[model samples]
Target: MKKQKATIHDIAEKLKITASTVSRALNDNPRISEATKKKVLKIAKQLNYQPNHIASALRSGKSRLIGVIVPTANRNFFSSVIRGIEEIANSLNYKIIISQSYDEFDKEVQTVEALLNARVDGIIASIGKATENFDHFEKIMNKGIPLVLFDRISNELEVSQVVIDDYLGAYQTVDHLIQNGCKRIVHFTSTQRINIYKERKRGYEDALKDHGLTVDPELIVYSNMQLEDGRKKMEEILKKKISFDGVFSASDYAIMGAMQVLKEHGYKIPEQVKLAGFGNEPFTSFTEPAITTVDQKSIPMGKITAETFFELLNSPNTDTVAKKTILKPELIIRDSSK
Candidate 1:
């Protein structure tokens, strides 16, 4: 038969001390003598004793665990954000459990539910591209767990969120192209249901209106914003014989595909068809005629999100107003947009 694990009672018996004293010593209670703690620790090492974190969490009602959900891990933007979150969390002695939604609504729901079941102290997330119903997020707050969202967020949820100023970013991108003589600029995006895309689209239209240019519905194209969608959108424009001098994509992935099609069609970037995209992905800098894009400040946004979670943890005021932080994006000038 396997030997039974040593208990605190065994340690106390060996030391000829009370179990309460042994417990206090093991816990490093200031009331215990330093010599007694040293003795207890030595005995614990001999027995290879390990504290059960599950039991500790049950007793203290704190798991010291944070849950994080992101749309996908393939993008460097999300990875950089995670690094920022981890840096702050490690300093604060908190562990984080990360989950990827793969841009699927069902996957997001499942990940959120699993984290709730794990009894995480808090959650930080960016809503998936396909996520529409926000009841799962509300359920987290209803249970008194602090919730923070970043990048993709919903205004309906009264949770703290860190996000980029998509409207201003889009507006500035369009203004740059217009100043460079891109009269028939085309806007590439996915659905308007997501807040970021919606704001970007609104900014694009508003900028055109501000410049006394017509808002051509034909100039705006909407799709999944995937690689295939980007390629197809470019092809469709050529087939339709639409005249355009510039392109503004809501995501770097879309622009990457669009650029390939543009080059194949003998278009000279910036000189002929200026191009820009959101999210200053690493590839944007290395691509031939490096793509001009907007820096979302993803890392700082993650740090702020984590800091907000700490604030929520320490706050005594239950009615603390949610912090809605929006970071401004900087336009990165590159060969693609000049």
Candidate 2:
């Protein structure tokens, strides 16, 4: 059997008021008195009345929905950022749809297209590693849709974005290792053209130069910064007879893998080899020897990203310049680098 859906007329009939008055009360219009609003809402709930957002959007031309995209939601950093975005969006009576790219360029393009098709009010995204082309992002700007990016962002697009101080974080970590009597430090970075990795790699090189150490070509390993990639790269370095006393990776997962291989090779952490990584993942603290790393400040990043998107959406001037917000990173010294 099919059940009939309740509408404003049903509530009006129950309260003996006009349908127009019921509508104003449900919308919390100032013309409706608080007493009338309470009664209308009570009966509305009793009747299981559900507002049709799609119809409302068609009338108002505003969906009040924000779409968020990330590389992968499985990471603690990405999930924490989503939570922060949700906290602000919910308070503003806006809903968010989350999509993951899974580090695939094709999937990222498809997700953007789907979100646009759904007519989201705005979008917030962290670019995937496999994304090199900017056509999809350019399309969003071409349509004058508000787009805000965070963390793994690209400078190719003239959109607002939020990011942490990757260069400063990497410099601080490498400098700390140097202060602790490490000279032959190995740097694990990515081959991708992403700004985050580029900045971190530049920081590593500058730190080595500042401390009077030559940048050893053999010690610089490039990869996707995954755990298995770290293990394979470390083994390759060992096979080539490269001697490195310290390791600083752009990712905690990669550093973790490197740690495993070093242990299997009978190398003592912070004794024969010092280790540090970026992104303070939870497991970093629970390892055999807690890893020293940099905190990305995911919660605040998410909140600020969502706030920036709303600001752009509300700005009267459509020609407003894009804003870039950079937050400071914190370096946490743990037993692994001591």
Candidate 3:
């Protein structure tokens, strides 16, 4: 309206250089001399030069945009992870595209395909529950762009991953319940296919074995980790008369459901039956007789995943070799558990 904005051509004209040289200098390409870079930067600042990132991505191979896929965006864990990722990414002048797979396989495939077609510089994801086949992930790796996974990952693919110490978290929670004198510990779990749930199950089983407690299959219940599943499983436990004194759940939602059922049945929490859950979700702390839970270090895990993706961008040998990073989880004691 007032005046036209300065272009690379304008900067070149002012500095008596080619537009290509101006472009390189603006981008800080090493080929451009230091003196030229300083000059271009100084003049660009004066002109208030705003580089078109999308246009530049088309011209060059880098979009400075990373795609992030998670099982659900609404979940607190994934939302916190996204925050951490954005913190690092924003500092590096990059942006992210987010997609939710809804824990479905076909949706995951479509999400990956969309991100790929968008020509993202990198992708970070947590595998969905139904994502048994990894051909969609392989396509991303084949594209030679960095694909870093976090939280939920596949054992089959060789990819960079950042995850919590699920086994340790589970083990510690169970140990605490046992130390509080709960002899019969019941585990409320998701499917065995998910690596996080699998690790949690192993930890629960191993913790019982370590403490010389009987490993009772009757005490273990698979509920797909849904709220309704938790409620039904709790009822099922009562009907079966398995005689459990403690409950450890793979998810907070499930534990909350279990708590509801327990309260309805007039069972005293911690005094009679103890409860613990994974994920230090916001609701866990606010609920009546606050829940004891394992903090997954979600924010830090997300930052680490984004950092790993950036590291691969500068690496000399670009192979899809698996790089693993695991973080310790802390157990938070609360009124729900003794």
Q: Which candidate tops TM-score? A: 2
Order the candidates by TM-score, highest first: 2, 1, 3
Q: For model 3, how does the per-residue alpha-carbon lDDT over 198-282 read when each residue is reduced to its tens digit?
A: 9999999999999999999988888778789899999988877778889999999999999999999999998999999999999
Model 3 bad stretches (over 4 Å): 1-55
Candidate RMSDs in Å, in order, are: 2.8, 2.3, 4.2
Residue 123 C-alpha lDDT in model 2: 88
For all candidates in order, the CA lDDT equals 0.90, 0.93, 0.91
What are the runs in model 1 whose C-alpha is more than 4 Å off? 1-52
Output the number of the lDDT-best candidate: 2
lDDT of 2 by residue, 1-338 (tens): 99999998999999999998997898899999999999999999999999766666766788888989999999999999999999999999999999999989999999999998888888899998888898999999899899999999999889999999999999999999999999999999985578899999999999999999999988889998999999999999888889889999999999999999999999999899999999999999999899999999999999999999989999998888999999999999999999
Error of 3 at 318 (Å): 0.9
- Evaluated against the true structure, the overall lDDT of model 2 is 0.93
Candidate 1 on 27-84: residue-level lDDT in tens? 6799999999999999989988775545557767888899999988778899989988
Q: Which residue pairs show backbone clashes in model 2?
A: none
Residue pairs in clash, model 1? none
